[model samples]
Target: MVPVDTLHDITARTFASDNYAGVHPEVLAALAAANGGHQRAYGADVYTARLQEVLQGHFGPTAVGYPVFNGTGANVLALQTMLPRWGAVICADTAHINTDENAAPERVGGIKLLTVPTADGKLTPELIDRQAHGFGDQHRAQPGVVSITQSTEVGTLYTPAEIAAITAHAHGLGLRVHVDGSRLANAAAALDLPMRAFTTDVGVDVISLGGTKNGALFGEIVVVLDPGATPGIEFQRKVDMQLASKMRFVSAQLLALFEGDLWLRSAQHANAMAARLSTGVAAIPGVRITQPTQANGVFAALPLGVADRLREQAAFFYDWNRATGEVRWMCAFDTTEQDVDEFIAAVARAI
Candidate 1:
């Protein structure tokens, strides 16, 4: 046997995306614990079963979770199962499905996205009405589902009442509701509410529950709050190539996040770091906070040449909008106060 050697800097950090952060130690421990045992394949194992019990405790007994490999797969599978061949989804133009997924929902899932431009990366009932029409028009793709992202792409949040309003309006228009809850934990932490408070209790039909961003090595779940709203998901998961052959490991990671307070604790810390970063940077000359810091991401508009200079210092982040010189900085569960402070200093130097 050969020993593995480290290939990268162990202390390197980035605000590019939470996905860049390493796995939570607790999730790694869960993986180690689930390793030695042989379990049934393709979601028929004890760990998979236990995951359901745990999710039910959080989301209620009517909820059922199907584990998948990533957020894109979970989103595609959830939407694909909720709609028909000609069915389209209404979402904000800045949605991950519309922008970040590289058209996986369109190319892979064969679903059309009816996107509306939003100033704050959120959708209102009036905004939904923009695409909610044309139901019986033969030339148009039928609008069957409305998908909203929680702790949205620009780091904005949808309150419980806001979500409830969208759900009610969508249902009245015969459209099912889907929440792309990849940052759901951050929302829960910021709102000081449980998972179901803004979801199941508010009439959300389905959710794409995130794991990798919060603390897991890799995984997400397609949680059905209203089983009748999404049909054929069990079969569609495999059809979309999201079914993991060694399902217990995936289930174990999800359980590690949801089984206790790990999810909340990690999210709260990340959100706090983002708030700290937002507050620190807002005071700097020529830096403008562009959006509300309601989650684990901070969006700001930087002066020309500032972002490039900051990246040169090994403090990496992404440009949210090149036209506006806006950049996005994401804080992960592992991001420490020192990391935030050092990055703040770097930004000051760059400016």
Candidate 2:
């Protein structure tokens, strides 16, 4: 097999997933500048502390940040701390934890997911209870955490109030709450609320706060919010191999993002691009809209010929598992209006 990077030279670009995007300018500059500085190793650097302080303002004093290498590692570290070996995490059927992470929570963390049926990839408290109850006995998997993904896998979002309800319900049942916040900034901006509204005040125990998808080259914070729930997350991250030795690099990226509200700007740009792409794609004949462009992605049910032709024209996208017969087009911090227009033109010609 040819290495993807070896064969691919940048000619034209299209929506695929936010992960495919490059680091934002600010984040890049921070990493480049941080290269010359020597700081404490293993996350005890000034940069890491500064980022945490900034996050303290965003998520309020109720939350604390721990820099991790990527979203999966962050999720695994956060969830592992919250759940027991016999516990389960409740999530939407199409959640990233279930579909994208290759079941690492099960294979790597020794936990199970109590998958709830999701139409738009947002899991509800009702759905959680449906799966959480029957297995209360030790004979079956005990639900220890109720997990949610913001700007969910299907490009939908839950209101802050909805999240609070879900969190309250889960906590009432003695289950902790975790957010696979790989797109959390997008969600927070869309909902027009402070991060703390959903993360701390709303009762989330831990969150995998995303950075790479929005702007950074690589970094996400597994924010430990409800510190009382699960202990030893610091130790858990170290042993799980998620900790970076020269942790200042990871921490610097976050500091750059949080300090100037760059996270919000990146998320807003991505969301706007997704909306732009959705509108353009919908205008093309034979293209059927699949979901609302709520965050940084759009799902469309295009004719087979249209999908195929778009691919032929240097366009890129994913075949979403929840789409049945549609393509999932995602926007990112680097996605421009030019990209959206070019992809729309391709779709029009193909159909």
Ten-residue segment with the worst summed lDDT in candidate 1? Answer: 1-10
Tens digits of per-residue lDDT for model 1 on 140-207?
A: 99999999999899999999999999999999999999999999999999999998999999999999
Q: What's each prediction's clash count?
A: 0, 0
Instruction: List candidate 2 stretches off by more than 4 Å.
Output: 1-11, 321-324
- Reference-based lDDT, residue 310, model 2: 67
Best by lDDT: 1
Best candidate, TM-score-wise? 1
Model 1 spans > 4 angstroms off: 1-4, 8-11
In candidate 2, where is summed lDDT lowest over 10 consecutive residues?
Answer: 316-325
